[model samples]
Target: MTRQDISELYRGYIDCLNRQAWPELGRFVHQEAQYNGQRIGLSGYREMLENDFRAIPDLRFVIDLLIADPPHIAARLCFDCTPVGELFGLPVNGKRVSFTENVFYEIRDGRIAQVFSVIDKEAVRAQLGNDSP
Candidate 1:
């Protein structure tokens, strides 16, 4: 697929996530997708997202940046929400925080086959009144 097509596909995937469209997720994600270094298939991946939404009711993914290179896509997703309890092992406890997650995805057969994500835990910690290490 062309870069534009891949980027469009990714945007649709993000939209699906934002809408919590679990049934339509298979259109964008491979059934045997892997996240980080773990091979957590589609069901596990969906469960993870569901848990995230449960923890942060206002959770929404805003794309701050997106770059597509054929089979690879790099994205910076911005989040501004309050978690019910803790986030990233920090006691957020409904305190509003803003952070960015840098993520990379590998596409195969027009679907996301793998993902590597890094959240800005330090940013969240500082926002929650913790000292930067």
Candidate 2:
């Protein structure tokens, strides 16, 4: 796929996430998609996403930057979420939190097969008052 094609796929994927369209995300993820150092298969990933959405309630992913090359895409993404329940051990319920993450995607055959990401987890910690916000 050309860079444009891959970029659109990335956009669609994020859009799906923003919409909480769990099934739509599955359509673009490979059987085995690596996430956060774990090889989470499609079903596992879906369940994880559902759990997170249940906690956050209102979650949106914004693409700050997107770059596509053969079989890989680099994205700087901003996630805005409202805490409706407990997450990461914090009961920051009904509050809003915004965080940014950088994720690298390895794609093949128009499907995302792997992802590596890093976020300012410390910032998240602070937001929940576990650290200085």
Candidate 3:
């Protein structure tokens, strides 16, 4: 896929997530997808996303930055939401917090085959006033 093609595809994938269109996730995520290093297939991927939405009902993925390099995509996804309980093991407890996730994706056959993601947990911690360390 061309750089533009991959970027558009990624944007579409983000749109699908924002819509919470679980059924359409297969179009963007490979059946044998891997998250971080674990091989969490499409079903597991969907479940993870579902759990995220359940925790933060207002969760929305906003792309603050995006770079498409053929089969690879690097993105900075920003989030501003309130979590009902713990988020990344931090007690957000319905408090609004803003953070960014730096994620890299490897697209295979136009579907996401692998994902390496790191969320800004320290940002959440600071927001929650738990900055010990």
Candidate 4:
């Protein structure tokens, strides 16, 4: 895929997530997808996303930055939502928080094959008034 094609594909994937189109995820994610080095297949990936939505009812993925290079993509995804309970082990407790996640993906056969993501936990901690990192 060209750079533009990859970018468009990623945008579509983000849109699918925003729409909670679980059934359509396979179009973007490969059957053998890996998340953070864990060999979680497409079904596990869907389950993880479902759990995320359940935890944060108003969860929305906003792309603050996106760059596509052939079979690779790097994105900064921003989120502004309230979690029903603790998030990333932090006591968000239904409080509204805004944070960003820096994620990278490797595309294989025009689908996401590998993912590495890091969320801004310090930002959440700061918002929660917790100095301890």
Candidate 5:
């Protein structure tokens, strides 16, 4: 996997996410892709995306920085969206929030096989206000 290829894959993946096109996500991930440390098959991944989009209609990923090496890439993605429904059990209706995450990905055969992400959960909770711990 070359850096350019990985970068392009990520770009398309982000595009799919932005468009909420869960089916297109299959083009970039393995059959057994994982998210949030959970082992999710491609169908499960699609379900998760659908659920997220249902909850956050305006969800998007802003690519602030991307550092790549063959077979791996680390990204600093700026996330922004408004909750149109409940998230983490918080009934925050249309509340806009912004946060960032550091995501490290490992690619195999030009597909993202694994990933690790660190989200600003505390900030998310703070944005959640009374729902926050």
Candidate 6:
């Protein structure tokens, strides 16, 4: 896929995620996907997302930054929501917090094949009443 094509595809993926359209995930994610070097495949990926939604009912991925380079995509996903309990090991406990997640993805065969993600735990901690990193 070209740069524009990949970028559009990623936007579609984000839309799907925001909509929680699990059945349509396969259109953007490969059947054999890997996340953070672990081969979770598409089902695991969906489950992870579902679990995230369960933890944060108002979860929504806001794209603060997006960079697409053919098979690679680097995205800064921002979130502003309240977690029911611990989040990123922090005691959020339904406190509203805003954080960013830096993620990288490898697209293969026009679908996401691999993903690497890092969430801003410190930001969440700060917003949750603890400033210490």
lDDT of each: 0.94, 0.82, 0.96, 0.96, 0.81, 0.94
lDDT of 1 at 60: 96
Error of 1 at 41 (Å): 0.6
lDDT per residue, candidate 6, 42-90, as tens digits? 9999999999999999999999999998789999999999999888888
lDDT tens string, model 2, 1-133?
8899889899888888888887688678988877977999888888888887888777778899999996899999887788776656667678787778899989976799988888766667787778644
Model 4 lDDT on a 0 to 1 scale: 0.96
Q: What number of clashing residue pairs does each candidate have, in the order they appear? A: 0, 1, 0, 0, 0, 0
lDDT of 6 at 133: 65
Error of 3 at 84 (Å): 0.4
TM-score of 5: 0.86
User: Which pairs of residues clash in candidate 2, taking residues 3 or more apart in a chain or in different chains?
Assistant: 83-94
Q: What's model 1's TM-score?
A: 0.97
Candidate 2 lowest-lDDT run of ten: 124-133
After superposition, which runs of candidate 6 have C-alpha atoms over 4 Å from their true positions?
A: 131-133
lDDT of 1 at 7: 97
lDDT, model 3, position 81 = 97
lDDT tens readout by residue for model 1, 1-133: 8999999999999999999999998999999999998999889999999999999999999999999999999999999998999888898999999999999999999999999999999999888779856
In angstroms, how far off is 40's CA in candidate 5? 0.7
Which 10-residue window of candidate 3 scores lowest in summed lDDT?
124-133
Whose TM-score is higher: candidate 1's or candidate 2's?
1
lDDT of 4 by residue, 13-129 (tens): 999999999999999999999999999999999999999999999999999999998899999999999998899889999999999999999999999999999999999999999
Better of 1 and 2 by lDDT: 1
